[model samples]
Target: MENQNLNKILSGEKLSIDEEMVPGTIHLVDLEGTLNVKKESGSQSNIILQPQPSSNPNDPLRWPKRKKLAQFSLLWFWAFMQAVAVNWSGPIWTLWTETFDCTYMQLNISSAICFIFLGIGCVFLQPTAMKMGRRFVYLGCTIIAIVSNIIGSQGNSVQVLYVVNLLSGFAAAPVDSLVEISTTDVFYQHERASYLAWFILALYAGSDLGPVACGYIVETLSWRWCYYIQIIIFGVLLIVQLFYMEDTTFERIDRDDLEDKIIQQMKSRETILSAVQSGQLSQERVNSDEKLNAIVSVNNSINTDDDDESVDSSIPMRTYWQKMRLVETEYNDSRSWLTIFYRPFFLISFPAVIWGGVVYGSQMMWLSLLATTQSEIYSLPPYNFTTPQVGLTNFGALIGSLFGMAYGGPFVDWITIKLSKRNNGILEPEFRLWTMIVPTIFNAAGLLAYGLGAAYEAHWFVSAGIGQWLLGFAMSSSGAICLTYSVDSYPKLASEGLVLMLFIRNCIGCGFTFAIQPWLTRNGLKVTTWLMFMLSIIINGSFVVLIKWGKDFRRATKNNYYKYSDPMFGELFKK
Candidate 1:
């Protein structure tokens, strides 16, 4: 009976059964055929078929609007918690120094390790997610992070702290990459910049909010509570995810089975037609068979054609694992990860990434320096606050992040959309870039104010306000533009491009934090910050060059970019 049903289905005979009963099975049948089958109980079922391989409305893209938004929100919250966990320890650096018997530099090393491992983990986790699928990778990484947090909280040694920080960073990598991919998966191309802007805003908000929350906690309770707090948060997020997050990977509809069914149906139709013409088949039988065959053939053709058209019309799909294989091949031939590392180097080596890096790095460096400098410079007897209070200077960054999130992100997207429409539906990635001009000018002015304020011992609020407003807007605009531009310009290699930007940006930030303090102390805040302000003007000003010549740059580098695409961008660029 099973064999007969299979033969009939293959021959494009329509079978009557609940469609849900054949879940995960691919049926290929002619669009114009009648399917008849007898059950074990001698019950006959007949289906007047249309075609095989019909479009299933069960795809993630076809999900209900509310359900889709809920998915995005859940992923956003997941990313936020991961960001908070990594940076929560940042504000409590002083406590760690005292408890672990380490210097400020040593504590910085631990924080740096978290970021460094984040980059390193992306190399592995991204490919793993591509291979194993998003849901599994995300769930697995969250579990690893939970365990890492538990182990980190119980650690007594500095060595253990460093190891756990690195492990936790490794575990956290999937959250960012997966969330970005998932957001891209659900949103349309036109809507991506805004969605991504929000995602980044959430990310920065978590980073900024972490210190304030952790500062209050460490001040009143033990430093261990910071980790404990994250553990609880992670637990709650994990539970929410288990109940809410749906799998979003693209499931390919099988074409081979459908093709075979169509072939069989065509043969069955010819047999029935010949029998009818020769008068071996009755008119009733002939009519029924002809009607069924027509229905099945049309159905099969439409299904097959739809599947073929979809594959032809859209970008080729390759899992990250498959791209990694190509990368490995290239690596074996070239004996280098140059293809991976050099992707962002072109952009990084560009004056824009560097200048952006300097302005951004300087902000971070000066903020750290000013925080610590407060106690020494002020010298108020009672208000001689400890390192944590100095760390409270991070609140400036928090304030800036909020301003950026609230104003900068949406402004960039709105302006870009308007400009894109003005260009007759052509959206240059550079459209989103023009919004950076005001922020750039403001950032330089902010630095200048911070410098004068700090050097002359002006009101603390003066330095904080200038720094916060400038840094907030600068971080918001630069981060939004750089990321959006890279994704738009190199949508295929967006992940790699971002990784490159992150590498150079953070390297500058970390390097300058060490150098900026000593340099400012020796040269005076006025000279140091003025120099930084001048440098920012130089760096931020280069956006004009990028906005004008970016397409030219892309054209010049197209060959290399195309070669890199095979390994870096996967099948997306093949379009």
Candidate 2:
């Protein structure tokens, strides 16, 4: 019966059990521990590596642990600095209004312009990254950051501030999209969530901690010093990246070719299982690493295309000079730059991607709320906190984000495996949604506590410590969950999906920043707080909808997914 099921799957039959399963629904868990496949070593021996590493020695997946870590750390730090440069102005906005002789609304518009460009930049830069190389985009953005900061440090007028923000937002755009894609390049699916959470933490740390540092800098020295210090740090970073950073972008077999190999391998594995069940071969032979490697080698030779001349064993590892090249021209994609730019807009049609956007965008709305209102609320009346004091309050959100990083990443990965085991080893993308309950509850309560606590003049801790902490937890965790869910549901389209999701998130954030002041002015803090609380429940609670029907949504899009996943999709589009 098990053999029959495997055969049916190989033949592309939609078995009853797989009616709602689609491209992303994977057989992830090895429940009985008898599966013959390549898997993670040590305690995670049963966990298979998704998109199993190619035999090519230079595959990022085949890189040494230390090498992968080095690449990740450099990218992570770049993302952190970009977030810091974009957000460092929030704490000093009051100082800026006085310094530039502008109104709070003018500063708010400047911030809004930053977000608009952030969204536009994601759409624009991603194509360049795809066409040139991620390394090219990363290096170019670093230069932009350095130049933007230099201008900012010397700026005397509001218009100069606008130019600074425009460049800063554009430079910061990759933090929202490409960093996540680069992460996926170096890590496998099982280990990705934790690092995705780390990416979120980097953003939060910079956005949260940058202002904390800005407060002290402005109070002691001057606002110009913030830009001056960033200029120095970015300069050092540019030099390090030029020598050390390796482009993760690599060309690999597409969806159909990978699926063919998987089908053939599964058939071979099933034959071995059948032999064991019939007492034709001993279990010890099945468990031997030598036996599995022999079988895998045979399968690879059988599956290799006739036209491909290069043997897997003959592929050489990349040299130090090759790795540090400014552009990965060897792996250049054949797709047109316009096609890459337009793909993300097309992905907005995917339900899971759209839902992921809403979930993540809601977090952005909350983040914008805190960013916009912190000074206004904390500086006046009950709190009457000084500049540095207001900046210090972000520490609560920072702490909350730390806990959120743990819960959203490794914890979710662990839970997904456990649940997959229970469901007969079939891992549905919807399994990722089950943990969304934690963030949903955290988000609603955090909004209420932060907003109502501030409205009623509660203790500083009530609003800052408890409320901001809860908000921070929900922001990071929920962002990770939804982003992971969308990517997992359409693994082939991960880059475009992320671009669309961030586009939506930044647009929402931009609009919220524009409206928050007016809304507060019209409704006062109490009403606005209640409305936002209700809004939080509606937005975050949406995980319930996805958890229940997400599989059906994936199933519905299967044909569309296959069509779009094609590497020649650009040519087809033109025709």
Candidate 3:
């Protein structure tokens, strides 16, 4: 029976399923631009749809395409800075250790703390964005970043550096979650994956560019130039935000349509008053007249023209300074404020959520290794490299990352569309996991090559060079795909999900950093790297485990966040 169903699905017949097994078909895309929603829902187009955009012109969903471009341009610039700040210390750890008389462990801990705080800060910042508004979070965080950098630039002690790191992490945390949330708020489902890939690129690109710039800065200038440069970047960002970032949260209750009804009521009340006074109407209607009078008195402030019910765009656009409000509505939902701190921990049960954390976190280990090990490898025998030369080595990883950024989105989207077509237009979240197969093979191959080459004392071009680039390509592509899949599968709770992913990713990264020196010293470079490579294979391969069990996990966790507590697994609880 299952075989027959598969054959029918392949032949383009609608794949049938039990309705109670899933929620509404809002996310299922069996065909491009068409969803396989039940005909009983009364969709005129015979398709299920979502993100059912509001008619409000002020709605971010309905904003002019030109405005969308302008808004995103500003957002990307700001987000790139946050990304750059997080990894600034990685390449400069050698300088930091010498300057502070601290050990490598202490320096690594300081860097990892910044990453950890990013997740910690997001837990509060995201819920605040949903409650108070994203505009305030974005602008406020940028301002904080500027102040943190200035203080960091002037700091003379190691303790001051630690405080600077903490403040930087806290201020930049909102960009990690809220920027992605803003993307979803503005774009449609079809465009989400591609746009998210762009976001990931801007974010991770910092990990690369920071090293490159810091390498040059530390060699030619003072170590403090790193902080100085960031201060300038963020200072400009703060000023631009004042003029460019508009409050996108909207409440479009159309009071203009209420104007006509209010006018007629007022006219009726005047007639009633006249009739009663002239003795043509009974005093019994006096009670009704009084009610009518009250209604008119309340609605007298409404302005209307003809029967135009559209929201008022007639008012002049707010001035640049006037548009700086973080949240325009007086509306408040207290529960939203709590989500930032609470939801990430609760979502640990979902397979999709686990994959997001594991895949992203594991791949980040390799990147962190590159940052942690670059100076040691290049500065020692076989290659006596200067600080600038050490920084240039990151170019290998950067080049590989550029490949992932350029091709990862299109590859994921193409495969998803193709898989959905073959499965009778049913677009399962699991379909995206297939993109991992290619990148996984590359990851294992690259790790083996790097380990073996390093162990055998092979040419730097082979082990440290090509191997690093391949690992980078694999990590960048896999991280992008995994994150996109998580968002695609469980977007209703993506804000919380992102924070959790960040925590898991940074912990794993920090874990790898701590283990790198110990493993190398005890087992030698080749053996330790090979062991890590083997472990990475297992982690990357776990995607299959998720694909098999993910649906059940989603059902268990599905819509649960909406109620703060809810049922799952469709009919499992029925007795």
Q: Give the candidate number with the greatest lDDT.
A: 2
Superposition error at 565 for model 3 (Å)? 8.2
TM accuracy, model 2: 0.90
lDDT of 2 by residue, 64-179 (tens): 77888988988989999999998877777777778899977888788888999999999999888887889999999999999999999999989898899899999999999999
Please tell me which model should have the higher TM-score, number 2 or number 3: 2
Error of 1 at 239 (Å): 2.4
The candidate with the higher lDDT, 1 or 2, is: 2
Best by TM-score: 2
**Model 2 deviation from the true structure expressed as Cα RMSD, one decimal place:** 4.9
lDDT of each: 0.57, 0.82, 0.66
Error of 3 at 251 (Å): 8.2
Q: For residues 26-142, write the lDDT of model 3, one tens digit per residue.
A: 333323222112211222222222343444444566566688779988888788888788776666667677787877776666666776677677777876776777788888888
lDDT of 1: 0.57
Could you tell which candidate, 1 or 2, scores higher by TM-score? 2
Q: Ten-residue segment with the worst summed lDDT in candidate 3?
A: 299-308
